[model samples]
Structure formats: structure tokens, C-alpha cells
Target: MTATAAFEAWAAQHHIDAPHIAIKQTQHAGTGLFAKQAIVTHTEPLLRIPNDMLITTKNATHLHLTEEFRNTIYQLFDGTDEMHLEGKNERLFLKLFLVHERFVHANDSFWKPYMDVLPSLAFFQENHVLFKNYAEHLAGTTLSVSISAKQRALQNELATLQEKACGWLDQITLEQWFWADATFWSRVVSLDEENEAVDNGQATHLALVPFFDFANHSLTPNVRWQRDSQDNSFLLMPFEDATIGAHDELFISYGAKSNQELLFLHGFTLSNNPEPLRLRLPVTPFLAGPSQPAISRFLQQNAMEPFVAFGYSHDSAPSSSSQVLPDFPIAHQLFASTGFTYPSIVLMYLLALDEDDGLRIDEQENIVLGNKQVDAMDGVAEYTSQLEHFKVIQLRVILLLLDALTYHHGELSQSIPETTHPSALTNHIAAYRLEEKHSFECAIDALALLREELLQEPVVIQYMSSQEQQ
Candidate 1:
């Protein structure tokens, strides 16, 4: 029997219900669930898998994980925040469990039918952004930068696993570990009560629900998945009044994700995706500048509220002597999709300011303060508010941003080859990069209009006249 047939038969034997849906390989996309019969909306669920059958951390422990192995895995979670413990490496136990089932477990293993159907390591290396071969398609794009970071993190995770789980029974090759991770990220879903219940009673918030994960992602999904606690299963529910035709492919929204996120996580990119591209700009020059500390201190004191509102606030601010800039608390990286991403624009604005423009760091108090001690300098806010200074700072900020965008966009443009026929991976990367460049172009046009308006301001004209007279 084929893999899908075996899985379907396995599901049927296990009481998983899906009377009207069947899995099939698509013409363009990979394997997906298709309707075997016309189904009306608000009717019976298309598919349901009992929660007990889910491949959760708790479930994995019960499979073949020894008491000793489970204890070591639990120790890995030591000192980690009970509430916020989710990342590439945090679920090493689950990945290790999957590896055991895939390699060590025989036909008698309960999870054999499902684990046998998962895509191979070669498939992931060819498709996933985490691998060097596939990541080459995203060269010169911000997604490539993200891919590199994730690759490094994955390697770090491999080292940690090798160090912590020192044994022969469960110690798998890095390739095997990577496959488990790829499968988990691409398939797992968090239970609804995850955030609230993870600390107290919940053993795990995430689960790989078989069959249900076969449905592909769509921005305009006809069906949605929900945890049916009453039924003790996860249910795929159709939207009200949304009729699905016979043989139609089922789709579910992966949430409002950007091209970078979709490419990184799901190994796919949607052309003209409704979400804006997340552009990660190079801030090395700004970070290394002599005024970097002052700029960070200024934003920390005067702009912490706005920074916090933008979700960029760090748990602990970096020391002034630290070379890292504080505004980009995560990685000292700047991510912007539009001129209106206030945090990016505000950081650029501060970087563009100087002592002449009323930016001063008071050593005595170790805080940023406007130079009211200097000639006619009211404060940093007041100095920038003046028409002449306002226009200059605005112009400088625009140019600084435009320069970064142009550099990245040029790299993307150059890396994309000219060919009449291209592979699917090439086409997808080209489309994604073009869309990102479009955002940069839009921002440039908006800044141009703003520049013209600023030049025409009465205060700007008056300041120019005074400068010419002097």
C-alpha cells in the first residue's frame, strides 16, 4: 500500500474520522487533502483526530522514552521560564523521541504508520530554507540573512543536544535531528489553552495532529481547525456558508504571516501576499559609530514608551559601554516594511542627529539631555520641531533609510538570474524578492513626496533666507 493509504487505514483502525476527505499529491503543490464528495458548510467535520493519538511531548514520552532519558530531557528545561519556553531547541525531547520512532521502532510500534509517511531528509534539504542548498535560492535577500541565523542556531542546538544527552540509544545524527525539527515546525499546532495552561497542568502545548496537518495554507481558507475539548479531538470545521466542491483541495490559514515568515517556517512563499515584506536592514555602521551609545541612551530615556509600544523593549537594557545598540534589543537588527514603522524611523532619526542638532549625553547623570546650555537649544524634541532643523533631520532620516533599502534591493536584483525557464524554487524566490523590492520602491516614493512638502514649508523658506543673509 502507498504511504497515504497506510496512514488512512491506520487512522480508520484508530477511530480517527474523515469520511469525505482523501489525501493526494497535487499537480504543483505537494501532498494535500482533497474533498472526495461535495460538502456543505456548517455540516459534519471534514476530519477529526483524537487528542490521545496526537504526537505531543507527553505522548512521545509514553512511547519508548525511558525514565532516565525523560529525566535528562526534563533537566534541559531547568532554569528556563515556565511560561515562555518555546524555540528551535527548547523541544529537544520531542525531536529525540521522533528520531527514535523513525529509526529504532519496528512495525510493531504504534507510531510506525504515521512516522513512515513523513518526508525524508533529502526532501527537506532540497526544500527547507535551513539547508545551505535551498538557502542559496534566497541569496542577497533578508530571508537569506534569517536563514543563516536559524542555521547557526540549529547547529548550536545540535551541540547542546550532543552535550546534554550523552548516550548511544537516542543519540542520532545531525541530519536525523534536523528532519525531526523540520517536521515538527512545519506540522505542529499549539493547543488553544497553551499560553494559559502551560505552566500549571499542561505537559505540552504543541502537538502534531496526523492527517489534519495535510491540509495546505491559504489566506482565504474555507476551513479552520479547532480543539474540540468536549469530543477530546481536534476538528477541522468549515466556514459558515462556504461550500466546498467535490475534489476541491482543503486549505487553512497559517495566520497573518509575511513572506519572510512563510518562507522560513513553511518553505513556501505566496506571490503578492497581502502581508507586507519584513525588511531587515544592515545596521553595522550605525552600531559601530561613536555616537551609538548616546543614541541608545536617548531613546531609552526619552522614547522608552514608544519603543515598548512597538514591542522592541528589552527585559534589561544593555550597558552604555556595550557596543550593541539597545533599540534593536533582539539582535541589534532593524526591521522595517514601511516608513510608518515608528521604531525604525525613530531610530534612524536619532542616528541622524548630532551635537549641533541638540543631541547630548550628560556624563554626570548618565542620561541623554538636550543642550539647553548651548545657544537657543531648547531640547532635542524642541530642536527637531523647529522648521529648519525639522526639515534637515527629516531629510537625513529619509536618505539614511533609502540608502539601506537601495543597497539590499540592488543585491537582490543582481542575484536573480535572467532566464526564460526557471525551477519552481527560483521562481518562488524571484517573486518574493520582487515583492520586497516593491515595498522599498513604495517607501521611496512616499519619502519623495514628504521631501517636496518639507521644502515648500514657510519656516523652511524663512530659514533659508536667513542663512543666505548671514
Candidate 2:
């Protein structure tokens, strides 16, 4: 039987069925489910897979492997407090289980049909960032940076897993592990918390659901999946408002994910993906600013825990922060007013404020200026008499954004490969970068408007005139 036919037969044997949907090959996404006939929104589920059939870390342990091998797998899977750390241990266990089933057990394995249909190791080597071949195409993009880090992480973890191995795991090659990593990352879904009772002692948070994994992703998905707690199965059904027509491809939203995430994890990029542009401010050291010592101290004090005005130290800080930027009501106001990322807005404050700026970190670690500790909930004057002071902050922010966005756009432009016959991967990299470029342009345009508004302020005009005379 063909791979698809065998896969369907396997699903049927496990009691998975979707009469209204059939698997079909497509120009993109390889194989996806399509509507066999017009299907309306209904109370009945389109497809269901019993909880027992889910290929989870909980279920894989029962496989007929050597006692030593099974013990090793158990130790590795249960040893980490970091199991929740991006599901690393869980995925590693699943990857090893998959390799063992496909190679060691081969045709005798219960999951042989599913294994036959899993994408080959060669497919991931050519397409995924986990492999070195695809990294060059992603150079100068955030995903490229992530690709480097992810490869390092995988190698480190793979080494650790191998160190803990016995028997069959010794036979698994690095190439097989990489392929299994790709398979798990692309296909695994987090089981719903509501279905916790139905896990049947598997107690695993992640699962690779049979047949349900075939539906491709869409931003405006026609279908949604949920754990049918009462039925002890995972259900795929049309959304209440959706009207799926005959022959139309079925789609389920992967989640509201960014292009970088989609490309890194799933090996595909969407055109005009609506995920917000992630703008991370590059950390520049505060070497000689008038408030450098004070700012540096504040950053150091709260470096371990996030809070407004603290947490981002001078030497090295992440491109983003979860803290609220304290006082300077104008700075706080600009954050909501300008939809800029919180870290960027906070960085603008650091650049604009000085020792003489009257902003001080009080004994309580609350940022206060002139005896007023402003917060998101507190009331303060609508406008300050220090208009010239606030104008400086706004102008500095405008210049910083313009320069950063322009430089980033230039880097992206230069890194794009100059080829007329671009492959799908190249196109995906180009489109992903294109969305970031567009976001940069949009921010630049908004900065211009902000600059124009700043010029209109009387205090700003007087300040500029005074500086010009100097």
C-alpha cells in the first residue's frame, strides 16, 4: 500500500475517522486534509482519536525494548526538572522512541505505518535550520540568530541524551536523532489541561496525535481541535461559524505565531503573517552619560528580578524586558501613546535622562522625581511645565528608532540571496524578512509624524532655536 493508504488504514484500525475529510497531496504543505463534501458546523465531531493512541512519552515507555534501554529512557525522561523547559526532555524521549520503533522494531512495530509516512532525515537536512545547509539562506535575520542558538542547544542536549543511553540508543545515529527532532517539533501539540483526567497515567503534556496532525495551518482556520473529555478522545471539528465547502482543504490554526517561530519550528513561512514585528533594542553600554552611575546602579539592583526602571544592566541585557518603566509620567504616557515595545521605550528614558534631570531612585527602589511616585494607576498632571525636557526625550527616541530601523533594513537587504530561481526555502526566508522590513518602514513613518509633532511644540521650537544660536 502507498504511504497515505497505509496511514489511513492505520488510523481506521485505531478507530480514527473523518468521513467528510480525505487526505490529499497539495502543491504546498505536502499532504493535507480536504473536505470530501460541503460540511457545515455541527455538534458532532468530524474526527476523534482515543487518548490511548496518542504517541506520548507516557505511552512510549511500554514499548518492548531491552530492560536496560527502557530504564535508561525512564531515567532521562524523568530526571529533568526542565521537562517543562520548552518540552526538551519530552521531545528527546519521543525522538529516541521514534528512532527505535522505526529502525529496531521496523515492520514489527505497532506504529510501522505512521513511521513509513514520517518525513525522511534528508527532508529536514535540506529544509530545517537544525541542519547547517539551510542556515546561510537565513543569515542576518533574527531566525538566523535563533538557528545558531537552537543548533547549539540541540547538540548539547543530544550529547547528554547519548551519554545516558544503553542498548538500542547506542545504535541510533546523530542524523536519525536530528530527523526525529524535526518530526517532534513540527508535529507535537500540548494536550489540553482539561483532558488531564483522561491521560491514563501517561501524564505527558505533549502528544503526537495520529491523523489529526495531517491538517495544515491557517491563520483564519476553518477547524479547531479540543480534547473530548467525556469521550476520552481528541476531537477535530469545524468552528461554529465556519462553512467548509466540498474539496476545500481543511485548516487548523497552529496558534497566533510569528514568522520567525513558524520558519524555525515548522519549516514554513506565511505571506503577510500578522504577528507583530518584534523590535528588540540593541544594548549599548552607558559609559559616560551624566546619570551613568545612577542608571547603572539601578539596573544592577533589579537585574535579577524585573521591575520598572531596573532589571536591564549596563554590560549585557536582553533585547526586551517585562518591567514597567517607572515615573516620568510623560515617558509612561508615551508608551501607551506610541505602541512601541516596552524595552525600547524604557531605553529611550535611559538615553534622555541625566543626573541633573531630577529623576532619582528612592530608598524604596521606587523611581520618583520631585516627591511624586507615578505609576500606571496613579493620577498626575496632564502635562508638565518641563515641556522642553520632555521634548528632548521625544526627539532622542525618534532619532534612535530611525537609525536602528534603517540599519536593520539595510542588513536584511544585503543578506537576501541574489538569485532569480529562488527555492521555496529562499522564498520563505525572503517573505519572513519582508514582513520585518515592512514593520520597520511603518515604524519609521510613524517616527516622522512624531518628529513633525515635536517640531510643532513651542518649547521644542524654542529649544531648537537656542541650540542653533549656540
Please report the candidate that would top lDDT against the real structure.
2
Model 1 TM: 0.79
RMSD of each: 8.3, 7.3
Off by over 4 Å in 2: 18-20, 37-41, 58-69, 77-88, 99-108, 164-177, 193-204, 285-331, 335-339, 358-388, 455-458, 461-470
Error of 1 at 158 (Å): 1.4
CA lDDT for candidate 2: 0.64
What is the per-residue lDDT of model 1 for residues 297-381, given as tens digits with 9 covering 90 to 100?
Answer: 5545654422211111111111112111233322212223223454555556656777666666565434243634322212433
**Candidate 1, residue 269: how far the Cα is off, in Å:** 2.2
Clashes (N, CA, C under 3 Å) per candidate: 0, 1
Clashing pairs in 1: none
State the C-alpha lDDT per candidate.
Answer: 0.63, 0.64
